[model samples]
Structure formats: structure tokens, C-alpha cells
Target: MLLPTRPCGPLLAAVLPCLASPLAAQSTDPGNSEPEPAGPTIVVTGALESRSLQSLDTPGLGLAVDADQIAAVNAINTEDVIRYAPGLVVRKRYIGDANATLSLRNMHTTQTPRALVSVDGFVIANFLGASFDTAPKWGVLAPGDIARAEIVYGPSSARYSGHALGGVLRLETEPVSRTAVSLGAQSFFQSYRYYETDEDLFGYALDARADLALGSGGISFAWRHFENEGQPQQWRTVAPGTPYAAQATIDDALGFPLRIAAQDSVVDAREDQFRLRANQELGGDWELRALAALLLDRDGTSEPKSFLTDGDGQPTFVGIAGVTLGRSRSAELLAGLGLKGHLGDWSLDLAVSRFETLDDRSRQSDPADLATGLIPQGGIVTDENARWTTIELTVERAIGPHRLALGASYAGYAGRSRTAPVSDWRTAAPGPVRNASGGKSELIGLFVEDAISLTPALEATLGLRYERWRAADGFLQNAGARVDYRGRTDAAWSPKVALAWRVSDTSELSASLAWATRFPTIGELYQASLIAYGPNVGEIDLGGFDPDLAPERGFDMQVTARQRLGTIDLTLSGYRQNVRDTLFGQTILVAGPGEVPVSQSLITNIGAVETWGVDFIVAAEDVVIEGLSFDGNISWIDARIEGNPLNPALEGNRFPRVPEWRANASLRYAVSDAFELAASVRHQSTPERNLENSASSRCDTFFCVSSFAFVDLKASVDFGPFALDLGVDNLLGERAFVFHPYPGRTFVAGLRWTGGRP
Candidate 1:
């Protein structure tokens, strides 16, 4: 029988009318309505040019989740909000929300994220223009401590640099308005089906902020901390089966019911962070701002190997014990001075920053079981350091129905690293290895954009950007000596054009076209190491740079229609990204040392591919009720490689890890002035394709994971001197799995007291 698609009809029918009646009685300026009773429009790095939903000017899809959304919902992290956004997919390796990987538009650009992340206008991509995996853990700022988050989807190469191929996620913390001290605590319980196990989780957050105003200048400082130890999920192991099963013939003739073994693979994580910003008006013509921040994160996990089947229909054991550790520290200093006189339309920004990261992985078997050496009995450590310096000059002027902006940027990067040799765990004879790499690079870009208000209901935007980049003096992926792959520079000129026409007072039709390019990251080019979880028995080596490699280029287009009527807002968008010279991961059979005859997988670049998809959003506020509302988003995708070439299984096959359909919905009702209620459900469909085009789950024909739906409810009440909130997530305590076995039934409670009004 086909499983249930979704159970949202009843929830929506009950909340829609309540949201409509009251809004119809209020003002028509929906743009003027605040998301919260008392709070500013949620705007941050992602929405730099737009401050409000009505004033937002963009040709892309973006989401701004305010701090209030976090506080009222008792969110766990950024993942909670992003999980409901359109065109984004997330899959967890083990379970829980801790160690999951996210993909956008079927582009697994990088192992982690090719997407860029920044805060306060500072780029968070590491030295190689790759999303810093270590950045998120700099202690997660409590939801109450956040001001807003800006998520820009689709290619934005014209404005943001690097991983702009996928998109950019910029997080902006709320500025401290007054002195305040707040504390909150929450907990949850989760379960899984395959393993027949349950998880108990708990966490808390504490925040302190102070704002000081001195001589027409202001300084604000804030600190945040969060910690949680969740229960582990049981892993399903392949039981010992006959040769028929091992040879892939079990589906032809089934004899006995399948039996499986189970193992527990749980995860634990923690984080802490601090931030300070000072803004001062220097004279009447200049404004200066200085910002400083620090962050930290740690996660631990224990996993098992796949069930080994010998021809006898008996189970054999192969276990692995290891821990993955990641640590990163970043410091940045930026000064933005806007001229108020003379060249009043010009602004200058200068920045200097440093980023450092260390990743250490250790593995071992039962120590006594040398015959089944699951983990190579050794450890791998990688140390990275990067320095960034930039100077930006921008000039903006508004004339009649036209707005012109021109900018030029010059930036330089330097990176260095060291590696140690892998030794046998039994011997423990390891000394400091030699330096593997050191490199320096420079980038320069000149950009210009013009926004023309052709008519009261129409706007046109034209933009162009010219960029040059080069890298030299880096180590080879094969640990030996540094290579002189330097003096390499390439220049590209890209353009973007967009037209937005307002079909009616509340409807808009828009289209955009652009060209974008992405360069190889330092990690992909210079870093090489052996991964344990590869197809090969020995070590899976990540190869080094191919001097003939070229930049990946793409021509992308998108069309969108958005309409707002009374209390309902609907949006439909379709996009296509045609990429040339796309780089992909390939496994190559390389000859091993001596007569070993070993094989390994290496990374390579692919020729061409087309990724296309469509997304829809239907959000309504008071359709029938006064204080009730609901919103839902859905997405569909179709992506594949052009001509079947090197990889036959993948030719004409759907891209790996790209789910065709995913959706989410939420319902909210304000019971009274001092109380509110909310309920939400999220759903993601099974994949209609292959696993990187290789294996398929025995439980399902496709690489498809089982579909699941989770429900949540929250309530808040306020007395004269204090306010309190209680929420229940995964209310049914179902043994569900989305991305992975997420926390089952869970709940959280928090309290807040507002003192004197400013």
C-alpha cells in the first residue's frame, strides 16, 4: 500500500479562517505589519539591500527567519528553520540533527558546502573559498540572541564570491538594544524503527547583553552558550546470508525471512560564542563601525561496519571504533565609513581577518581483532591557517528613476598546512611529519549595477562583474614535496539581467538570467589523504591537482510569479542551471606499491550537466479566522548528466542525493494578547534515482529513504511581570526517519521576564 502523502488538510482547514477574519478588519498595508508585536523587520547579511518584505528587491529566493521565530518555536539550531525552506535538502549520516549534510539544486559542490556563509559583511569561506565546516560550531548563538538570518538561493556569482555557485547563507545577530540577562532550558525524547531504540535529549541556553551609549556613539556586547547530549540510534546490519544473496539473487527466490543484527551509533555535541560591535559617528561626514567575534563546537560519534555475508547464511562481525574532531578559530576587523559630505554617495570598506582550523580523526578496532582491521588503527591530523585582507570602494547615487552602484574590490589570501604520516596503531611509532603545503593568492573584481524603475509597476536591473584570480606554490595531493603550480591566473567577465513587472497591486512576475564561474578550492587541489570508509580495502587516496583543470562555468535562468491577495501570499518559481566543465568525484584504479595490485578512487572533473527544478510557496494569514495562519512550501527537481560517458550507471540517471520532491507546512494561532499556539509538519519524499548511481537500499528499489512526517506544537503565556513558553516537538513520539532517525517525541519549556521598558 502507498504510504500517506501528508496529513495537513485538517490542520489547515482549522487555522485558515481564524487568520483571515481579523486581518481583513485591520489595515491593508501588509508590509507595515510587524512579524511580532514589538520587533524590527528581520534583515541581515543575506538581505543587505532590502530591509522589509515589501521593500525587498531581488531576483532570487530568500528567507529571513527572525529571532522571534526562534524564541516562540524553541528551535534547536539554524537547521530547524532552513529545514522548511524551498529547494534545499538535508540528510543525516547517523541520526538526530547534529551531523547532517545539506544540498541545494542537486549540486553537491563540495563534501560539505560549496555555499558561502558570512556575517556582518565578512566572508566566512575558508582560505580556499570553501565553506568552513568549522565555522558553525563556534558555539551556536542562542535563538534569542539572533537578530536575523538571510538565506539567498540560486547562483549569486555576480555579487558574492566563491561558493556563490550554490548560494549564500549569512547569519546576522541582533544588536543589543538594552542591558538584559536571560536563561532558558529545554529537553526532548526521540525514537527509531529499524533499530527498535529510543533517544532522550536535553539542552539549555544562557544569554547576557549590554548596550552602552557614550558621546553620540554606541557599543554593544553579547554572549551565548548551548549544550546537548542526545541518545544514539541503533544501526541495521546485513545478516549472514547464502551465496545467492551475496551474488544479488536474493530477490529472485526468497526462502526464509531476513534476520539482522543491530548496533548503536549515537552522537553528542556542544558549542559557545561571543560577539561585540561598536558604531560611532565620526564627525558629520563619516560613520565608523568595528566588530569582533569568537566561536567554538565539538561532536563525537561511534559507528559500525556493514554486515558481512559468507556463503553459509551465517553472520560475521566487523566493527569500527573512531572519533572525528574539528576545531576552528576566526578573527576579523572591518571598518565601513560612509561619506556624508563632498562625495556623499561614496562608501569605503576595509577589512583584515585570520582563520585557523584543525581536524583530527582517529580509528581503531577491538585491538585484539587484528584479522578484521576495520579502522586502520592509526590517526590523521590536518592543520589549516588562512589570512584574508581586502579593500572595497563603492559609489552609489540615485537619479530620477535610476539607481547606479559601482564597486571594486582587491583581496589577497595566504594559506599553509602540515601533515603527519599514518602509522600502524600497534606500533605507535609516529613523529612530527614535514610541512606539506604553503600557498598565496590574490583576487580582484570590478562590478557595476544599475536599477531602473521603468514604470510605476516595472523595474529592470543590469549588472556586470569582471574578476581575476591566481594561485601558486602549493603542496601535491600525494605527500612528497611542494609543487610549483603557481603563476596560474584566469580572468572572466560575467553579466546578469533581470526584469520584474508588477502584474497587479499585489502580483509580480519576474525573470533573471546570469553567467557564473567557480574555481577549484585549495582543499580539492592540494590536500590529499586516505579515507577509511571507501570502496577499497586499503586506503582511498584523494589525488592532487591536474594542471590542465579549468574553471566550472554555468549559464542559469529563472522565472518567478508572486501574488498577494488580502491575507494570502503565493509564489511559484522555475529555474535551470546548465553547467559546463563540471567537476566530479571519480574512482580510478591506480597500481599499488610493488606487486600489491591495489586500486583507489580519485577526484576528477566532468564535462557537462544540466540541473533544473521548480519550487512553490503558498502562505496565508487570516483567511477565515482572526488570529490564525498557515504557510507551506514545496519543490520538484529533475537533474541528470548529458551523455553517458565515464560513468555508465550515472548517464541519463538522476544525480546522486537529489530528492525529486520535498515539502513543509506550519500553523499558528494567537489565542490572546498574552498567549499564542503553533503547530508544524514537514515532509520529504523518497528519491527516484540512484546512490551516486551505484547501490540501492534493499528495503527500497531506489537510493530512496523511507518518507516521514513530523508534527510539532508550541504555546506561550505572559503574566504582568513575566512570560513563559512550552513546546512539544515530534509530539506523537513516532519512530520516524527523515535524513536519518531524528529525535523522536520531544518537548521544551522556557521562561522570560521583561523588566523596565526602554
Candidate 2:
């Protein structure tokens, strides 16, 4: 995603004073007796919510990308929002699409995100684990539809299983009102003027929902579609007997000698989701809710590989013939029921859900093959399906000033994949050739959390969790034998402790320590593939299963401070983490007579490592102008591997992808009763690339990605029953390259029509 553009002289000068100002006197609006609850400070992806960021007792760091600010970042998808978060990194290899990857703390290589992603509390990730380039495509979801996104960076292994090793992210959709139908349409223009190429994108969405009263129960239903023809990127290629930059751009004004591979790349994403839920109070002490949801997300793209390139310092163009990377399809379904009630002094909550997913892959050798079958091709490369059923039960009881909660959960996953029959594009053969075995994994967990007030100014929290995980073998042998390579089952216990002290009504201090664990994934143990690029072809063999492999464990400690001085609010935090039995991917060499062949790396239990960091945030409301405000946060972090066979000096090395510093600021002003304006800026420093492999030249020195800064502008107008939003993304079109070279100078304008009876 694109970073905000650099701010102008005036905007930069106004940030400090705006953030340092005292809170404005409680507004004395003519119609209201009290201010609107100070605009509702929300705390998400954290436990034990506090009034301000610093006093938050959560053990891990938390970030919330406001919808307004998200628009300013000019991100095409969700990952764009956290691309600059303290310890977060986002990488897109060839337009990620559905397979883009996001990492936290530079752990992108081995650790499955440790980060969990959920849309409305429903988990979403490449079931194979978080590292398979399965991050949700941002182009599918509209920025205008997002209410807010919360990112928690760190291993929260206790609360979640599967891919939540690095941290967790929760994206909340805008809530639907009782009865309303909203419609909106938007479009934008983008181009690299120097390249003599231009593109235009347009889309529209419709949302309708209503709550009906059935006796004493409530029922609601809601639906959304999003589409765009994205701008193409520059391309560079190295061919046989040619230098890396054999053919560079003639003028190379940008200095990155590369040719525009495509005049245009098209992106089409459509999602049709429906949710129906009925909530009812059963008798006086029992309540029940039943919900059913069907979500179908279809994304397709046409990428013309190396269609244009440089030939001897001049531009050479290729045909739009058949050359596409990924032309795939995916679908998911979820349905569930929940029950909550109270008996005496105890409260109870229970829920059950079923989830399913299907992915389809296809390709054609020649453009004419689509109609003439020039190469006789017929078969699906791979198909994956996942079925999950989960049940969770929780009970909470209050004794005096103490609250205790107990919970138990069981989850089962069944996933299977197979290749459809196919023959060479020209030859003729039918029926499936290679069928991959499917597998299943199951987990059961029990947890308890308690909050107690030791004194008027002090509070404490204690939490514990016990979990067991198991997976069955699902691999096929080269000799046509079904391989039973399932690994062993394991169990672990995790715990967390926190203390909060209220030094005064306006300030507080808190500290917490937590221990967590994560199990290895099926793909890590049995992935097999063969990849080909031009004349180079190689086999990828995921190492054999290691039943003796231990679960990765982590210990984290954090301290935080929060205070409010008049109109200004500030937060500061420091943290340290120790990880053990870290599962790292290690490349091993196999002896070959005349050539060197690289196979799948082994997933071994690496020694250990430590990470330390600090976070800072300051915000103010109503600076010089009544409706103007500003907020920002800065971060500093250090992560390293203690000692390993690869490098002993790596102990204190900085984490590869964890940038040394990152921060953001925004200024929003209400121009008139029906109009408002906003501008924002975000910046990030470069980060080390790799820390584990030292023998290679890749890590000789910490190579930093150039620093980038960007700005955005938006205006909103409310005209009675309808509202209009006009905005510009990356106003300066700086091409900052936060994670990748995102779109430059895009424009967006939308109109929303809303009407209802209160």
C-alpha cells in the first residue's frame, strides 16, 4: 500500500503545537448540556480497556487505524494500514493479490504470522499457515466500508492457535443501522506521466439493512460489491547472456533503470456476503441467538509478464500474448449459533460455528489456446477445501470486587487438496495425474482469567490457558505410496499477569508479563512442489516431519504510562520478550555430483532470542481551531538471535524487517456546518533485511530501505439527507515505496445517499 505523501511547510510546522495544546474547555454546545462523551475513545485488540493509550494494561502493543486516517494512507488493502506500524512489515511479490504476505518484527521467513486476521471475529488466513502469501487482498475491500482496524503486534499464542505466532489483527466492518439503505459510487485517475501511460478506475457499492422486531426478538439482514482496473507497474528482466541491467531505461530519470512492463494491469474483485441473525430472550434467565452468513469473494487479475522491458538502454515491447502468473478463484462460508444467559451470580456464553473454503486454479499456454485448444490442455492444477467446526463456552462470576472468568473451547479442522487431470497443452491425456493427500488437525483448550482490585488505586489481572493440538499425516510419496508422515501431538500451558496503578484521576501506570506457545503447521512439515522460471526448474520439498520438534515458546514483559493534561493526551510504553525453541527454517546443502540442487529447508528448533522496544503517542483535540485536531505515535525496537550455528554475533543484531523508527500525524478541521477537511502524514525508516544467514552477501550489512513520507487530503460535505466525500490519495505522488512501489497520485470521490425516520 502507498504511504502518505510528504507534508508541506505549513502542515509540518503546525503538528507540534497542535499536539502539545491543552484539551479544549468542555464545549458548550447550545443544544447539548455535556460534550459528546469526548468523541468516544475506543480500545480494541486489547484486554482491560483503559481511558488512554498509556494506561492500557494489555501486555502487547496495540494500534487502531481510524477509517478517516485509513483513507489518507492511500492503501489498497488492509495490510497497507499496518505497513508502518512499530514492528510490522508488509511485502508484495508481484502484486501479492491473494497471496501477499505481512510480517511483524521481521519474522516473515519462518514464523507463521503468529498474527491472526479476522473479519468480524471470523478468522481468515491461508489455512496452510500465515506465510503462504495468503493475506487478504486489499483491493477487494473498499476503504470507505471500513470502520476501524486494530493491530496487536507480538505473540499472543495463548488466546489463539494456528497462525497467531507473531501477533493478531482484527478488522471490524462498519455496523449497519436499524433500518437504512445506503448507496455510493467512486472513481479515480492515476498515471506515470513520464512513461506516457495512464489509467482510470471506477466502482460503486450498495448497502441495505434493517432490523425487524419479532415479538421480543430482533432480526437483521445486510449485503456489499467492490471492483477496479489497477495501474500497472514498471518491469525489469535479466535474460541469458545479458547483464542485469542490459537494457535499462533510456533516460532513467528515477534512477532505477527499469521499463514499464505493462501499459495497464486490470484488477476485478467482487464480494457478495449476506448475514442474517435473530436475537431473542428465552424466558427470564436464558437468551439465544442464531446467525447464518454466506460470503463469496471472487478476485481475478490479468498480468502481462515482461510485456515491456529495456533492451540495450532502450525500451523493447512484447506482445500481450498468454503469460499470466495466477488466475485463481476462492470462496468461503460461515454459519453459527450462540447462547448467553445468567443463573444466580454466574453468567454464561456459548457459541458454535462452521467454516468452509474453496480455491480454484487455472492457466493457459497461449491466448488462442482458450478457443482452439492449440496445446490440448484440460485439468485443474490444485483444489483445496477446508471445513471447521468450533464450540466455545465461557462463564464469569463476580465475588465482592473481584471478577472471575472460566472458558473451554474445542475446534476441529479438516482440509483436503487434489490436482485435476490434465495433459500437455498440445498433447492429449485426461484424468487426474497427481493427487495430494488431505489432512485434519484438532485442538482443545481451557482458560481462566481473573481481575481483582487490591486497593482504590491498584488493580491486578491473572490469566491461564491449557491447550492440546494434533494433526494427521497428509502426504503422497513419489512411488505412488500414501505416506503417513503425520507428526506427534503436543500440549502446553500459558499464563499472563498484569498490574495497573492509578497514580491519579488523569494518569496511570501499568505492567504485565505473559507466556505463550505455538505449534508447527502441516505445510511446514509436508509441502512438496516443483517450480519453473524460464529455463530454470527445481523441486521444493518441505522437510520430513519431526515428531520430536517442540512447540515455540515466548515470554513477554511490558510497562506503560498514560496521562492526560488538559486537552492533550500522551502515552509511553516499554517491553521485552524472550523466545525459546524458536522454529526457524534452515537451508541445508545436499551433495550432487555435477550440479547443486536446493530442496525444501528443515524446520528445526533454534536456540532462542530476545526483543526489546518502546512505543510513544501524543494527541490533542481542538488545537487553535475549534474543529482542528492532531494525533501521532513513534516507535523504537531491537530484536536479535542470541546464538546459533549460523552466526554467534547475531545475538544482538537488529531484526531484519523491523524498521528502526515509524510514526504518523493527522490534522482534521471542520470548515463549516456541512463541510470538513483533513490531512495526514506518516514516515518510516529503513530496516535490516536478514539476520540468520551470515555466510551470504545478503546480510553483510544492514541494508535500509530508503525512508518515505506522504500526505493526503480529503473533504466531506453533508447536504441534509445525503453526504458527499471527495479525496486525493498520495497528493504528491511521491512513490515512497513503504513496502513496495504503491500507486502514485490516485484520486477518489464518492457520494452517499442516506435517509431514515428516527
For each candidate, what TM-score against the reference?
A: 0.77, 0.78
Alpha carbon lDDT at 551, candidate 2 = 70
- Which is the leading candidate under TM-score? 2
Worst ten in a row by lDDT for model 1: 39-48
lDDT of 2 at 681: 67
Q: Score candidate 2 by TM-score against the native.
A: 0.78
Which lDDT tens digits does candidate 1 get at residues 373-452?
Answer: 23445544445565555555655566666666677776676666654544553334444753456566677888877767
- Top candidate on lDDT is 2
Candidate 2 CA-lDDT value:
0.54
Worst 10-residue lDDT window for candidate 2 reads 43-52
Error of 1 at 496 (Å): 0.4
